[model samples]
Target chain A: MMTIKEIRKRLDGGDISCRELTEAFLDAAKRDNPALNAYIRITEEEALRAADAADARRAKGEALSPLDGVPFILKDNINTKGITTTCASKMLANYVPIFDAFIWEKLRDSGAIMLGKGNMDEFAMGSTGETSYFGATSNPHNLDHVAGGSSSGPAAAVAGGLAVFGIGSDTGGSVRIPASFCGLVGLKPTYGAISRRGVIAYGSSLDQIGPIAVCAEDAALVFDAMCEKDPGDMTSVGSEPVTPKLTGSVAGKKIGMAREFFEVMSPPVREAIERAVKLFEKMGATIVPLEFPMLRYTLSTYYIIACAEAASNLGRFDGLRYGYRAESAADLDDFICRTRTEGFGKEVRRRILLGTYVLSAGYYDAYYNKAQLLRRAIKNEFSEMFKKCDLLLGPTVATTALQKGSGLTPVEMYQTDICTSSVNLAGLPAMSVPCGFDEKGLPIGLQLVGPHFGESEILSAALAFERETAGEFLKSSGMGVKL
Target chain B: MISLDELKKLANLAKLSLEGEDVDALAADITSILEFANTVSEAVVDLPKDEAAGAYNLREDVVAPSYPAEEILLNAAEKLDTYFVARKIGGTGA
Candidate 1:
């Protein structure tokens, strides 16, 4: 699979037409999607049409953005005008958006071709892709193992060379986890850095649409394009362009190694993270050992807040507006109840119930309010730590991709997001870059977390690591379009 | 552990029916999740002053051209004359 730069060079040199490139990706998706299940819907017609437009623009010598003519995958949750945005759930399985999402509009303007909607966990609720109503996305590295969720399909599609890069949303570890599992680069930008308008909300405060790519520079390119303020989403503050500042320099940088994150990692993950730290040290980065006791409370806080928001956000899915409607209901109330009960998957129902439990009158103070307070404490800890270090270095996840049908309980599954959730809670920028592989040969991701709106710093560090490793740990699955 | 009755009530509050499903297993799952969430109660820290209170990015109050009713209602399961169609209040089977 070629990087965006290489693809751009070829397109510029007239080595390949945009239509041909798009066809290559579409053909790859056709060939590999049966085994990978990465895409919920392939927009073949739209892709070719867009490719022709790109070719016409190039022919007319119109200015082209870096992503112009780039074929990519959009996560199913992000709305595309007249295209189905299912959130990988039965509830919205047939629901097509009348308007485009904010990020999609940006990408569309940049002449990015949409290959399809990537599969994800149903309503972006689960850590593993298994909860998706479409089907679990298989790990490209090893087909038996699961692709991490809820951005499983996007990561898998990118790793399998189905698309140049994929746009995915990260609530907890959705983007980064799968990228880590698939040996790709995933970035969850600082909260509110990108507009969430038309993004089906899960954990509204925690969710940020990010890029899943093969390298840090590619992630930076996509992030730069999408990070912008929008009137539709008031929380969106936009961001500085990190792509220009990716100097790939770690000299004199202070990288904090939080002991708490290290203590929870599996042996292989720990060794990989330790090796990454050593490499950064060799690159002239100062390692700052730190104690972040607040790490233990993050998972509970994240789930409580995320689920509470999810419950509220999903209330709009009543039978009247759109999506699945239950048949043979006695009344309005019954209609809604039956529709939701039948439409939502088991995991989504569980989260909704949990959220309702926490926000209920009597339990509000005990659960929701307590979680909010803990959220503040966690955010404050991250804020303080940022003062001591340029970035926080740790494992993206505690373990590698688990085999399909691992059948871990719900709570156990939620525990896997421990390493990635805190970044969302604190509304910080973070990226998961492939560092090494486990004994099973699954990829291990080293996380670089930065202060609020500190995308440039973290991305710079990630690029430096990517440059040093020179794609050593970033092995290909040898499945998709190889340009 | 959450009782079956409590689980049913919570499910009702969430607008979901617990019919024909494994209520016992769901109850166990929710109970364990609640137990996991209970760990937050042990966190000892002064509640940091809420810095984000009233930090909303309020756009100028202007009437913008909204999506046409036909377009907005394009995805509606049932619609009539630009309005979403729903079951009448307190009405029985259609």
Candidate 2:
């Protein structure tokens, strides 16, 4: 129950050994993982070895960084050399990468321990984690409810006290929604802010690896370790250099609450975010008002554009290489067709079909190009709104944690991502922090979104809010984990 | 609404096979999805190209040692030594 700051302080002060800290998390994971199903593979041996190395470094006064001994979870989609990166899909059920993801390499160099890869929706496809081949991750708040995904297990693992922090790729609400559901802090950095070199692609344009932690400060620390310009990634951009100068004060800052974000949220979610707005005002943050009609275009724009990109990105999985292959095939064509047909789940196939249709010659102008234009408009809409305010505030998800077997149809399911997807569409920095819990005792997350490359402003606002409210929430709810 | 033939065609293009109940389900799903996608048409306009396309990085063209051939092929489904055994095209190399 220690924050990364306290843990590092203790480790530095020789009060706790890295091996001892890792073993404590390992024991807790072992006790809780059976029912929660938080991790796909518990790399105990590797984690212990890394912890011992960290201990040795500390012993020699040669620790690599402040996060040297921290244990963190990765969404299964990110590659780890010699570790199977299944992406929680049958398609890549046995696929192990020969190289580490850029983020993983960065963290590894920092001496952070890898707890294991956390389960996700297949190919990061679903709003709920139920689409995972390994199985749905249970929300830490309630056993029968879902850990909102596609970063379900990562969120669950962090919330369930299984890891110090987690790394998840947010395409359309993957990291943020789960963080909301689990009552954690999840940051989806500006697109290209974090390198995507070895992440299994879902939407090449929208996918960015971000941090999920118990609070904003920890998220910022983990993000600092991982955010770097990778020559390997063409889209990777240089660091914005925010950490050293994080003035966690939002006094006199203009915090905008979009009318569109409030219009459709459930009552409890609205109340929590409204309460958060009042708190921001109390903290001397100015409240600005704005309405956006273009916000309505996001769900469709994100689906079309993401699917289109996914269609092309996933074309490499044609059964000739690593991953699940059909046993029965008469020819090369049949082999590919059957391999994909059998390997992919229903939702993944549905997306592939939709993506193909959008990019098809006949429908290209109508679907793909139109979505791009709408994407531009949405970006422009935000650009204009930022002129009136410093950051945007809203609900991360329309509702709290969904029931595990809600059996909501796909269209119904898509609505779960309504509040968060537009941020991904515009490639902006957004954070979801625990605001309060609802009537069912499930957590409610308050979202703070900043303008492009404005992570500092948003994180500062979020940090101020957390510092004000953390003690009360921690005392009452005990951090949203059932155990 | 997408027809069964259209679904099949899309599946073929995606290198996937649709059989049993998937065809009907996908058709219905695509229909609803297309209905949602239709919303974009209203906002579509021929706008000029963006003035600031953001800073893009161009790496120098340099030859670097890559993952070894054996290591790279470690996950290939059908492989013989370092060579991947792929489907024969053009009948014995013409």
Tell me, by TM-score, which candidate is best. 1
Per-residue lDDT tens digits for candidate 2, residues A277-301, read 8999999999999988888889989
For model 2, how many clashes? Answer: 0
Against the true structure, what is each candidate's TM-score? 0.98, 0.96
Top DockQ prediction, candidate number: 1
Which stretches of candidate 2 lie above 4 Å from their native place?
A: A475-483, B44-46, B49-55, B88-94
The DockQ assigned to candidate 2 is: 0.51
The CA lDDT at A103 in model 2 is 91
Q: Go through the candidates in order and give each one's C-alpha lDDT.
A: 0.91, 0.86
Give the range where candidate 1 chain A is weakest over 10 consecutive residues by summed lDDT.
A59-68
Model 1 C-alpha lDDT per residue in residues A1-483, reported as the tens digit of each score: 678898899998899999999999999999999999999999999999999999999999883699999999999999988888899999999998898899999999988899999999999888779999998999999999999999999999999999999998999989999999999999999988999999999998899999999888899899989988897898888998888888899999999989999888999999999899999999999999998999999999999999999999999899788899998788888888999999999999999998999999999988898888888888889988988998999999999999998989999999889999999998888999999999989999999999988888998998899888887987888899966
How good is chain A of candidate 2, measured by TM-score?
A: 0.97
| Fraction of true A-B contacts recovered by candidate 2 | 0.62
Residues B1-94, candidate 1, lDDT per residue (tens digit)? 9998898788889999988898788888998999999998898778653545225588889987988998888888788898898886686975
Q: State how far residue A443 of model 2 sits from its true place (Å).
A: 0.6
- Candidate 1 Cα outliers beyond 4 Å, as residue runs: B48-54
